[model samples]
Target: MENKNLVDDCLFCKIIRGEVPSYTVFENDDVKAFLDISQVNPGHTLMIPKKHITNLFDYTKEDVQRYLQYIPEIANAIKKAFPNVTGMNITTNNGKSANQVVMHSHIHFIPRFKGDGLKLMTRNNADQYDEAKYNEVADKIKAQF
Candidate 1:
């Protein structure tokens, strides 16, 4: 049975159910890893929970831990399968504000090399390291924890 969040319309859910085509690399009861169609790099892949959840904020502690615990094994498999993967980047975009296109929460496993010409970051001119502000923000987040 599907939860209200796991609609047929959700792309990841369709892939999980084999209703849509995907280059599936790994799957367990709780998660699935597949080659990303967009292929940000030659071996870019995605790991997602089999159950649909909108974003990181929607994950329960158990859900998050269970899915994340499999990442290292999945990442190692990707590294072994892809050539010249000197490094990897595990990224998750959380919300619309973070440019999350897919509603389902997923981690991007981007294989990196010495000169792949891929860059995950740019200088944020407005970003500043303010000690006082850092402490204040840390305290607020700590409260939630």
Candidate 2:
């Protein structure tokens, strides 16, 4: 049976179906891990679900469980494959505003070393939030539950 979630023209879906070439590192029935063509680092990798869900907001409960289950194992394999890797960043961009180029949901495993020149985030407004602001934000998110 066809997986209704698979998008016909999605890049990651093409990679998943072997219609596009990729430097695939690992793959199973549920997910595929491959080298990011735009190597932010030497061992930069992308782990994506076989299903073509757009982003985290679209994942079902079972999708989350199956997708996350392979992260630890794949991360360890990446670390082991690269002896110089000191640390790692596992990130997923949720939408176009979040820098998601492709529509498929993917987790990035970026290996980090001291002074790799990659700046993942900056704290420009570290002191902007006070207790009241913090509580207001927290309460808004908590109310959703």
Clashes of each: 0, 0
lDDT of 1 at 46: 93
lDDT of 1 at 57: 91
List candidate 2 stretches off by more than 4 Å: 1-4
* Residue 51, model 1: Cα distance from true site in angstroms: 0.5
The global Cα lDDT (0 to 1) of model 1 is 0.87
Scored by CA lDDT, what does every candidate get?
0.87, 0.91
Query: How well does each candidate superpose onto the true structure, as a TM-score?
Result: 0.87, 0.94
Cα lDDT of model 2 by residue, 1-145, tens digit: 5667688989999888888999999999899999999999988999999888899999889999988799999999999998889999999999988899998999999999878999888567748989999899999999998
Q: 1-145 in candidate 1: lDDT tens per residue?
A: 6545467889999888788999988888889899999999887889999889898999889997888899899889888987679999999999998989999999999999888898777586446758888898899999996
Best by lDDT: 2
Q: Which candidate is the best by TM-score?
A: 2
Q: What TM-score should be assigned to candidate 1?
A: 0.87
Q: How far off is residue 84 in model 1, in Å? A: 1.9
